[model samples]
Structure formats: C-alpha cells, structure tokens
Target: MFYYYEKDQKILASERNDLPYAQGKPIPGAPIYYLVEGDPVLGRGSFKVNHPGQLKAPHGLEVLDASRLPEFPLDATLSAALEAGQLTAVNTGQVGWESVLSAAPSAGKKRLNILAIGDVGSTLLTGLKLLGGGVLSSIGICDVSDQVTARWEFEMGQINLPWDYNAFPDVEVVPVEKLFDCDVFVFVASRGIPPVGSKVKDVRMAQFETNAAIVKQYAKMARAANFQGLWCAVSDPVDPLAKTAYLESNKDENGNWDGRGLRPEQVQGFGLGVMNARAAYYAKRDEKLSSFLTEGRSFGPHGTGLWIANSIDCYDEEISRELTQKTVTANLWMRELGFKPYVAPALSSGALSILLTLRGEWHCGSVFLDGVFMGVKNRYTPAGVETELLPRIPDQLFGHIQEAAEELKRVL
Candidate 1:
C-alpha cells in the first residue's frame, strides 16, 4: 500500500506511481481513507473495508484493502476512527473526488428549497418549517402552479408560535428559475400516482416512468444552474429518481455523460426513513418481533424492493421476513382504508431524514451503491458521505439486500 498526504488528509492507495495529488509522507492521527477504483457493474454488493477483523473490498477492487498494508497495524486511534466512521473509502473513479479531499467549511444555517407543494411536498415542507430552525435559515417553495405555492407560503407563514417569531424557518414562494439557489434542493415533484383505490399493487413503481421524466427535466436545470447543494429525492420511486437526477445532470447536449454535474454523493434518495419507521411500528406491536426496535436495520428501496432485518446479531429470518412484509405493505394498508399514505412518509422520510442529513447525523437514505441507489444508514461528513459498515451481516440478510439491488437495477 502507498501512503500519501494531501494537506491534513491521509490517503492510502494501491497504486503508488500515478497518484492524484498525493505525497509520500503521512500525517499522524489524521483521519485515514483508502482510495480505490469504483466499478459500477462489478461493485454492486457492499463489503467490509474498514471493520475490525479483516478488510474486504468490492470485486476487482480488493487490491486497495487495508489488510494488504506491509507493516500498518490497527492501532487505538485507527480503531476509534473506524468505529466513528472517520475511515472512508474514497472512490477515485467518481468525478469531483479531488474536491472532496479539500477541506469544506460548514455552511451553518443553510437555506432550503422545495420543489412542488403537492401532498408529499407540502407535508414535508410543514415538518421542515416547524423543526428546521437550527439547521435552516429559510425555506423556499416552488411549484408549477402559482396557487399551490402561494397557498403553502401563506399557510406556512401562519404557523409561527405566539411571541416567538423566530422559532421556526420562514417559508416563501420562489420562482422556478431560483429553485436551485439554496444550499439544499428537494425534488418532490411527481406525477402518475395511482388513486387511493387503484388496483395497482406497486404504487411507487407505477409512478417511476412519469416521475423519472419529470426528475430529468429539473435535473438538467440543476446542471445548467450549477447547483452545489444536496439534491434530495422525495418523489415516489425515490431511489431511481435520485439516480436519474445524477445521471441526467451529467449528460452533454447529445446525452453523453460529461461528469460535470452533480456528483453521486450529492444526490441521495430520502425514502428509506419511513420504511425503517414502519418496521419499528410493527415490531413494537409484536413481542416476537420486539428486537427490531433496537437492533434492526432497513435496506433497499422504499417500495417493493425493501428488506428489513429483525436484528443484526441474532437475525431471525422468519421473523425478519414477516416484518419485512409488514413494512413493505404498510402503505397499501393505508390505501385499503381509502387514503394515500403521504403524511408519515413526508415527515419521517422527507423531513426528519433530510434534517438529520443537514446536521451531519446518521440517517437512513438511499445512496449510490454499485450502479444503483441502494438504501442504507449513511451520513454526511466533512470528508464526504460515509456509509455504516457492520461487524458482520448475516449471509441470508445480505442476500436479500443483493436481491433488492438487482431489482432496482432491473427497474432503472
């Protein structure tokens, strides 16, 4: 392994000869990161690259494993960094990776902008306006319909607490051209949602084609505007739409990827939080599934492709499968009662998770993995996006996750 230091950051790479901007010396006690080439098709599965025991890497990328270091030892500081998620694997294959190595000053009290004030968007906007005072300086709302944006702006303005005018983030209607002006741009514009009583079993997937098209249009707009904020996908079929935003924004006029638009780490799908919440809801009601509340984790997409683990350590496949079924169909249970399940999703996935992201806290969201946006527990860091790596994931549980990724790959 080759150790290099760029400013205060320390990087270890497999290839020593043609390094990006790395030097030979390493800084003591600084955060350690392993640099590896990312292969979209072959790197579909997650691996344990920074865990305690043995380091693993995605297929064709194991040459950069930490275990291959000649004399490097997992000392106390390095172990602590691993547990704290400070140790990351930088994808040198990604565009704009050099920018990630540079120190980024915190943009305290950011401005947030929301597109479309429909059911999901409006509810999410309300949650953010009420709870985002510490993280957000202001909230901008934009929609194709003037009446809709005007109504939400007026309604959100009336939600201030008595004698506490500055307690919440103020909301205002923004023109379409200025939608990406803020530090965070949330894409909540969706179309072709099946009605409450529609016969469609997979509502999220049903809206994908239409929603993908809508997402592409705004994605290009974000490209043209050179949007530098986090792009949150809250529309139905969030995972694919998030990928669509990243892929579309990077295209040239002839639809060739130019790698000049939003980076993969910048686009995140905010649809998994509600799935995790719903799993917990079911787990709370069933004593047999009670372990999920603390030890469980949700993986994959928000809809048909999602999987839930009852416990990471003592994973009960039967109980976990049952819980997964309940969580996956929770939205359908609401539809059966003649209602669209938008409120919980908007708040749990869209608002709460996005707030956690802005605060740089651990949150459940779909991040780019392999060639698809796979939902997982991830957080933003000064270095970049860091995903949680468990000590061990049961083979059965991991298989379900792989299947979920394949399903998403087929859809996109």
Candidate 2:
C-alpha cells in the first residue's frame, strides 16, 4: 500500500517503497505493514503489496511515479541491522502490523561461495561465517593450499564468533570443483605482489599488470564450469580484474570474436568503498573541511587514479586536493601504527559491497564502461548491474577521473 504523511491535512514526503530497498520475502497482493515513529496518524493511505518477495506499494504504481518517488537507498547500516537479527516488522502509524515472512534459515536456499582463502580471503571467511548470522546459508571456501583449507575447516568447527551459532549451520571448506556451483563467486587469489621492496604506494595499479593475467585463467575456468552467479574481483586493481573476467569469458569457437563468457553485468570491482571511507576520516576532524561529510565524493579507480572531490556540490579546488591526498595516504596510517590495515578494507570494501549487492542497492564497484572495466557506484540485480548516474557532478572531479581513465588505458 502507498503511504502518505498528512501533516496539517497536507501530504509531506516521508518514506515510500518505490525507492530501491530490500522489500523482504513476501507474496503479491499482501497487506500493507507500516512502520511509524513517535507521531501516529501521519501515515494514511493504502496499496496492495505488489509481488512475492517485493515491497508493498500504492495501488497502480506507475513507472513515472516509481521513478519520481524520492530515491534514498537503504544503506549498509540498515542492512547490517537486518542481517544480525536486530530488526523485524514494525507497526504502521495506523496502529497495525505489516505481515512479513520469516526469512530465517530454511530449506533449499543457495549460499555465497568464496573461491580463495588467503590473507584477505581467510579474514573474509571468518567475518562472513561469524557475522552474517542467518542471512548467508552456507559458505563454500576453496584454496589451492591444502594447509589453508585444513586451517579453515578446523576454525569453523570450534571457533565461535560473536553471533549466535547454530543459526544458519552450513559453513563449509570445500574443494575448488565445488566452488563454481554457488550463487556468488568471490576471487581473492593472486600471483603478483612483487616480492619485497616493491615500494608501490599505488598497490592496486602496481598489481594490475600481473593480476590481469592471473584473472584470465579463472575467467576461462568459470566459463567452462558454466557458473551463473555474481563474479567479484576482490584483488588489487579491481577494475581491470573485473574486466578481464568478463572479456576472457567471451572467446568464440573459431578462436575469433565470440561473446560466450559471463555477462558484463555479472562481474564487479570492490575497492572504491575504502577510498570513500578514507575521505570521510579526514573530513570529520578538519573544521575547514567538515563540509565534506555532507558533500564529498570519491570516484574513478580505487588506485592512483582516484578522485577525491572535497565538496561534490560546492567543488572547492583546494580542499578537494587535500582530501585526495588524505585518501591516498590513509593506508600509511595503519602501516605506521605497526599493524596491517587489512581489517577495515575487508569490512568496508569486500563484505559491505557484497551485502549491498545482495540487497540490490547502489555501491562503489567496477562495471563495464565504454567496452572496458571502469569503476563506478552501481547496483547488482538478478538481471545484471546498473551504474547509478547522479544528476550533476563537479567538472574538475570528472577531469581527474578522465585522467585516471587515460592512465589505466596506458597500462590495461
């Protein structure tokens, strides 16, 4: 059902289902369930719960109307709460409850399959298995090293994470042959860290040349296996790796141009989220740059090509430069503190992007751009990926983004 807030006998825009969000699992024509805050009676109106596993909407929801409704996306906080079992159905202002099915652990639900388990991969395994609660059913962890595989199995058996165990009950360390059969495939393995003294500040770009070659092998492997799931590049130089997977999958039968690989939409890059976070860190303490919390944007590759615009809406050249510098050096902060900064990158970049992808909301990831891989904020759906294009952007920020593209072109 459509809800309209009537304040002083007039409509004030509040929340609507037309905007993209996880509508929960349900049937169409389901009754409307409302969630109202302190003041009741503001939400008044009705509409049919549109489709199975869909959000309730006002009757006769039109395309234009859906588009016109405010486009605020349900971000990571909401998703995390919902995943950890912190939230459930709430009452509408009309003093009633919305009917919702328990998306609890049930039969026949396919879970995400992770293909590698190394430093980033092993940490990711621990986080997803422990923190995901009931949202993920089973995790299929694979690694080339027998030692790593054995280690994960031993940990999952006894090590308890903060969340209640026995909730979902299916975290498995499986063989690589079993990895391709799941709903989501994450690639974190690589052969390109330039043995010590690499001195590569731009770690992502430095690994691109080698990671590109490494990813192609898996792309072919994935295609041969006929896997139909979200393929993510969690390795460094994410944008290029994402493209490599897509391109390598499409070789023709005659050793010519054929498009049989994974769809361009199925692959994604997940490195930009950390860049956004670093910019926010610097913006909060600097009074002159405090406005960035409300108006900053980080764009382009997750590497040296990144554009950290100080004020996305206001566009201050000086502050933008400072913000960019902070983002580039954010990693060094952890290095100086005597610990590897892997935790935040694992959480903010990998797990967060995966959560957003499952929920079908916008996030920073690699997508197909002009016949190649380009980093952009977008949403992943069952059909494919759709890049979110904001109405307006600072020209100077875009110029830097273009330069990044040019630099990427030279190497890629």
Return the top candidate by TM-score. Answer: 1
The superposed Cα distance between candidate 2 and the true structure at residue 17, in angstroms, equals 36
- Segments of candidate 1 deviating more than 4 angstroms: 5-15, 20-24, 29-34, 40-88, 103-105
lDDT for every model?
Answer: 0.79, 0.60
Model 2 per-residue lDDT tens digits across residues 335-373: 667565667667667877777767668787766543445
RMSD of each: 3.8, 13.0
Model 2 compared with the native: what TM-score?
A: 0.69
Which runs of model 2 end up more than 4 angstroms from their true locations? 1-110, 159-164, 194-198, 252-255, 336-339, 382-384
- Residue 69, candidate 2: Cα error in Å is 20
Provide the TM-score for each candidate, comma-separated: 0.89, 0.69
Whole-model alpha-carbon lDDT for candidate 2: 0.60
TM-score of 1: 0.89
* Clash-forming residue pairs, model 1: none
